[model samples]
Structure formats: structure tokens, C-alpha cells
Target: MEEQEIYLLITRYLQKETTTEENEILADWITDSVDNEQTFEEIKLTWQHTEQIKLEESTIALARLKNRINHQQDNKAKTKKLVPFKWNAVAASVAIIGLFLVGLFYLLKPNDSVPTTYSVLKTRAGEIKTITLIDGTKVSVGPKSVLRYPSVFNNSERNVSLDGEAYFEVSKNPHKPFKVNTGDLTVNVLGTHFNVNASRNQILTTVSLLEGKVEVNLNSDKDDAYVLKPGQELTFNRANQRVFQRNLDSLNTLGWMTRTLNLSNDKLSDAAVKIENMYGVKLIFADQPTADTRIYAQFNGDSIEDVLTIICASGNLEYKKQGNKIYLNAK
Candidate 1:
């Protein structure tokens, strides 16, 4: 989670507006690290102090605090010698009070400025869904996917969490970049169209850009980031914690959106995953060689059996069906 979103969550927690799940999320984040715990404690303390002050005084007090902070920063920059640290009780108390008001000033802002809560959208196997966010961003969620987004985005940025695959058509807001948080990486964009395949079951997380530029960075190492231009794709391997980029194929990357299964030199194993995701069935190879065989095929709005039959024929393979599981072997 971003720092700004953390503040919004803390504010919601303080106001008793958080849901049970939200409370748990906040608790987990707080316990994740010492820095997170300290941040939560500081915000909690500041909120308590702010409650004692009148609401009308928040703006003036916050203004004064900003001015004081800016003045101190300027002084520190101009002076070469470090100032001696002396504990003045009165001055310290006044400074703490100033921060208290600053916290209140932000928390008490208009409702639209921050999200009071979040909503979760999920799609079952073989199902696809789409939603429009408060910022006019459109998201088409793929099968077996989960997406969590705020009711209203904070003024600074738009944040959302995703699991599985999603195609995004983000409304342009250069001032507030849109971010998608997946399990292993984050995709940052300033109003662009993109497809993110970060499914939990998949070992590789892929981010494909269709229209605009996007920055993909690993959660473990933010500095290890890749900027992808249009028609480019970035793949992050979770097992190796490595990333590689390649030119993206629109049909292969986004065919699911239109019920078009386009396989351009896809390995049999990889093609099986696509079929399983679309038809909610399981595919198993009888041998490793058959799984490794690559095939090129396309199926537009075809039934699961038809799609599998064509693939098996093209690869000189045969498949046996037992319930929802399909086993493939070399013919």
C-alpha cells in the first residue's frame, strides 16, 4: 500500500468507518514492520491530540505548521553546522500540537477527497466481468480474478489491488497516476490501456501495454523497474525473481477479452493454461515431450471441445476426458 492510502485507512479506522475486513487489512499492515507500527502509532497519537482542538482552528494551525516547517528546512539548508539538540518541553509540546492539527486538517477534508471504504469485485471460473471506477476508469476482469478498489480515490493518486487477469482503460489524470498492486509487482500508469496477468496460480506475472506507457516494478525491489512502451510486455518470474521484456502480440495477449483464443507459437503446456482459464477445466499431459510441443492455433468463440480437438490435431496429440480433467498424449 502507498503512504497516502495508509493515511486514508488510518483516518477511516479512527472514524470507526472501516469494515471488519478493512480493520484486518490495517492490522496486518501495521504488524508487517516496525516502521508501519510507528506510523500507525504516530497517526493515532496525533488524532487523539487533534480531537481536543476546535474544528475551525485546523486550517490556520496547519498553515502555521507548514510555514514553520518550510522555514526550518530553509535554515537547515543554509547553515553548515548542525544545531545542538536540546529538549525544551514547551517548544516540543507546541510542535506536537502543530502536527496534531495538521493531521486533523487532512482527515477532516471533504468526503470526496478520500475513500471511506473499498469494494471487492470477483469473477468465477469461465466468467468475465467489467466495472467502472469513480474516476471513470474501466476494468475488465478475467476468470477467477479478484479486484479491490476504493469507492473514491484519494486526491493524490488512484490505487487498486488485483489478483488474476485484468484489462484496464484508465481515464487520463497526469496529476494523479493510477496504480495496480499485484502479488509480486505494481503497474503504474498515467491514463493508459493495459492488460495485467498476475494470477496466483501462474508462476510468471505479465504486464502488457496496449495503448500507453507503464512502469512495472517488483515489490521486493522497487529500483528494479522496467518502463514499457506501447505494444511491449514485461514478464516477471516469481520463482527466479527476474524480469524480461518482449514485443507484445495483441491477439495472444488480449484475445480472452473477445472470446478469441489466439495461440501464436504457444507451447502445448502454455496453451492448456489458456484453455483451462477459459473453460474452467483441467488439462494434464501424459508425458513431458507432449507438453513441450509448440503449436499455432486460433479459435474464435469456439466450444471447449472444439478448441481442444483442433489443438490436439495440430500437435499430433490425442486427449482423453475424465470428468473435468483432460489428459493429453502423443498420437
Candidate 2:
């Protein structure tokens, strides 16, 4: 396909004027590479933002859009032939112009709503914080986490972005659905108590529900949403994009909030993972046999040393700490 044709097709696709065949072609092209998908997202975001701006401010918006596109072009200069330079530039320009014209036509459009202002809440390592949103929704943010939410939710929906982990007690609002976006997945709820863990280092993003119900939607597959009830948990593997749901421990899910460590017949290696996350420490095993040991225990509001002592005593194991690193071995 020619660059110009692809650009026109993309422009038509964005305008919702594409035929089924054209849409299929565009979809195939986007799915062909990650770069194509990212480029499409950038153009889409720019087009959407332009629509929200007033006609009088369109010149500034256009300038910003062009600058952003140019910056992207510079970044992709070495691989210009990947998607064809003309296609990206032309598509971006056409989309921006189309949005500006649409905004102009809506100059007399009734202003029924105000824009939302977002605020960011964050917690550093070894820190935990609790916050109540404007809608009375409570969020308990875990260590090394960030939550970005609007000061006031939109009339139709409550949306927030989260990274790392948080326990959410959503305020019941039947008219407005609540959504928690964690980059690759979105958790939707009318009113629910749920815990979400989306740490960057982990291979899986987990959502554990304690009360009411919630729906989790994978960004890669919108139709593959998973609905969960209380006592259920959904895990989305980032590496393979696989999703699985199973029964979960509601109390254990809130362990971070209560300073409790629950290890119900867990393997030593698995327990080490929990300890590492909870205490922000590194666990080194002296040998494979020792690391494979199993233990069943619960440490409620116990110090790391105390918990380790109990584990070691139960399995006849030994451990020594050197700064932030702990080494374990069989006695």
C-alpha cells in the first residue's frame, strides 16, 4: 500500500467513516508491530484532546499537535520506512485539521459540563498512606505506589489511574461506574471493596475482590473482560497476556493494610517473595534445598526478624541478615 493511501485510510478510520474492509486493513497494519500501535495511540490521543478544546484555542492546539508529531518523527527518523514517513505526518495533520474543523462547527455548542482536574497521590518505599477521594471512596495505597485521580469525578463515571498496589473501598453510586486503570488493565465497579497489585517488577497484575462485584478489562482484548464476585481474584500476566481467576483469601489480600503476613502452607521460595515485597528486602538462599522448604505460619504485625525466627524454628532452618539482604539456609 502507498503511504498516502494508508494515511487517508487512517484518517477515515479515525473519523469513523471507514468501511469494514478498510477497518480490517487498518487493524491488520496496527497489529503488525508495536511501533504502529504506539503511533496510532499518539495520534488518537492528540485528536481526542483537540476535540475537547474550544475553537478559539485551536491554533495553539494545532501548534502543540504539530510539535508533538515532529518530536515523534525525529525519534523515528532512523526507522522512517517502518510505517512510511508521509503516512504518519499526513495522518496526524489530517486528524488535527478534522478535529479543529469539528470544534469550529460546535462553537455554539452548549457548555453543559466543566473540565475535570486531576490530582496525584503517591507513597514511597516502606511507606503506606490512606486517602479518601472526593466521592467518599477510600484508598489505602501501598509502598512505592502512585494513584492519579480527578478532584471531582465526571457525572457518568469515576476514573483513576494506579501503579503499584492499593486497596479500594469504592463508594456506591449506581448511576456512575467507578474505574481503576492500571496501564494494561482496567477494573470497573459500581461499588466494591477490592485490592489491586500492579507493581512494575511483577509478571502479573492481580485484582482481588472482597465485597460486591467488579469487572476487569484487559486493554489488549476489550471483549475478554472478567467479572468477579467477593472472594474472587483475577490475575493478568503481563508477559504472556494471559488471564486467570480463582478463589482468594479476602483477609490475606488486605495483609499490607493490617501489617499481617499470612503464609498458609506456602513454600519457602514463595514466602520469600511475600517477605521481599512487604519489607522491601532481598532474600538470598544459601542452597536450593533450603529454599524449597515449606512452612505454614501467620505473622500478625510482627517484625521481619521475628517472622524469620519463627520460620527458621519451624523448619530447622537458619538465617543471617547483612544490611537489606537476608541469607537463609538449612540448619
Candidate 3:
């Protein structure tokens, strides 16, 4: 299709007024070549970013085109005969829209030259992995977790999406703020050490700051933002869209980084959850009382059997281990 025809069809498509035939024509044109598809995407992106064209802007644009036409008239006397007056009017309209589109393209085009491409890193059950991001940030991913990030940091910001638990020691870069998006909540920081637990099985997503400051922005309500200092923690309950902050022990918050499990008078049921997550085991309680029993202990790099043995001995309970499952019962 001619450039003018393509722009017209693009305008119709943007306005959602394209006919079936026009749609097919545009689709075929876009599918014919990669360049065509990229052009179409650029046009679409520009159109979405630009505000609705105002009548005053269009009129001013047309007036500017008229002055250009008058200037061309001065040169017309020295050259061949100009196109017909009707053709000039039609050309003027197209020029106005074209100028508006060109201005929008330049005004709204992304400043960064880097193309955005994403890479996903995931860990299965009973697995833990560490990754160094392009920006030199170190991330320790816990079991059953996935992190999706851009292959390269953009000029504007560094962003990554996470699901499950991870410890991040972000490299210091104040100019490019780093952001972690966990669907329901977004954590923003410059250079900071933080632990985020956003496991799908958990009711609340927790963000614990180890060093530096970070801002937690709620997805449910964009206006809600909480700033967390070092040793402070923020919890976001997605169900009720409630967010609260509290002081947290830095050791407890950062323990998972070193495979250190600490339970300070934690309920048996809560500890069970932590054990299950840490060791990727299924803990079944024989009765509600056994599950509700409380215990206090700390385990550093302990095997699953040792941890369970300690828990059972402290609670006067018996635990039978089978493969990846453990059964806890009152002895």
C-alpha cells in the first residue's frame, strides 16, 4: 500500500472504525515483512502514548501548511505548473495529519535505545539458586519461585517481577531506581538489601528491609505507599488489600539467605509451614493439638531429620519420616 494509504488505514484502526476489508489489508501488509510489523508497532505505540488530537492543534497545523504552500507558490513561478487546486486541498489535509503524527512520534518515542527483552529464572521444589543481574544485583531465589526480569536494565529504571521468596542485595545505583513487582505489591529501592516472601501459598506478602530504605507501593491502591527503613518490615494482605508495617529482627529476616531457620517461640503450625517451605517437605499432623503445639529453636544448615527430631523432642511428639513427607503425632 502507498504511505498515505497506510497512514489512513492506521488512523482508522486506531479509531476502531476499520472495516473488515481494511483490517485484512492492514494485517496482510504487516505480515508481509518484519519492517512493516515494526512500523505498525511503532505507530501503535505512538498513537497510544499521544493524547487525543485537538481541533485547535489541527487548525494550527493546517495554517502552518498554508504558509508552506504560499512559500511553494513563490517557487512555482520558476518551475513547472503546480498540481490542481483540488489536489492541493487533499494534499494539505494529509500533510496536516502527517505532521501531527510525526510530532507525536518524536514527542512520545522512548528515550532509551535498548530493546526490552525479558528472561525468566525459576526454581522448582526443594531447589535454591542464585543469580547475578545485568546491573550486578545479586538475587538468591528460594524454592518454588519465579523471577522475570529484563535482560538489560533500561535507561529509565530497573524492574523485575517476582513470585515466591527471594533475597536481594541490590547494587548501588541511585540514578536508576530498582523496582520489584510482586503483582499485588511493588517494592522500589535504589541500593538496598531486602528479603521478599510472596509465596503463592502464603496469605500475606512480606517485604523486609535489611539495609537502606525502600518504598512499597500497593497495586490495589496506587495512592498507598509505605517507606520501610532498615530492620523494618511491610506486610501486604492481598485478599483485603490491607498493608501494615512493623519492626522485624534483622537476623530472622535475613536467616533464610544463609539457610538458617530460626523459630522463636513460634507456634507448631507456623513452624510446620516454615519447615515445609525450607525443606520442601509435606508435614501432616495426626491431630489439631499436635499441630498447634508451640516450640522455640534455631537450626543452621540442619538436615530435615535433625530439625524434625528437635521439634518432636521439644513438643513430646513423635514424627515418622517417609521420603519427602513427615507425619507428626503425639507420643
After aligning candidate 3 to the native by TM-score, how far in Å is the CA of 247 from where it should be? 1.2
Cα lDDT tens digits, model 2, 89-124, are 644675545643334222323573335568898886
- By lDDT, the best candidate is 1
Off by over 4 Å in 3: 1-115
Candidate 3 C-alpha lDDT tens digits along 156-178 = 57899999999998876666789
Ranking by TM-score: 3, 1, 2
lDDT (C-alpha, whole model) for all candidates = 0.77, 0.75, 0.75
Q: TM-score of the candidate numbered 2?
A: 0.62
Candidate 1 per-residue lDDT, tens place, 5-71, comes to 5656677666667765676577567645544554565566457557566757776655654565456
Residue 64 error, candidate 1, Å? 28
Q: Which residue runs does candidate 1 get wrong by more than 4 Å?
A: 1-115
My TM-score estimates for the predictions, one after another, are 0.63, 0.62, 0.64
Cα lDDT, model 3, residue 237: 88
The ten-residue window of minimal lDDT in model 2 covers 100-109
* lDDT pick, better of 1 and 3: 1
Task: Report how far off residue 166 is in candidate 1 (Å).
Answer: 0.3
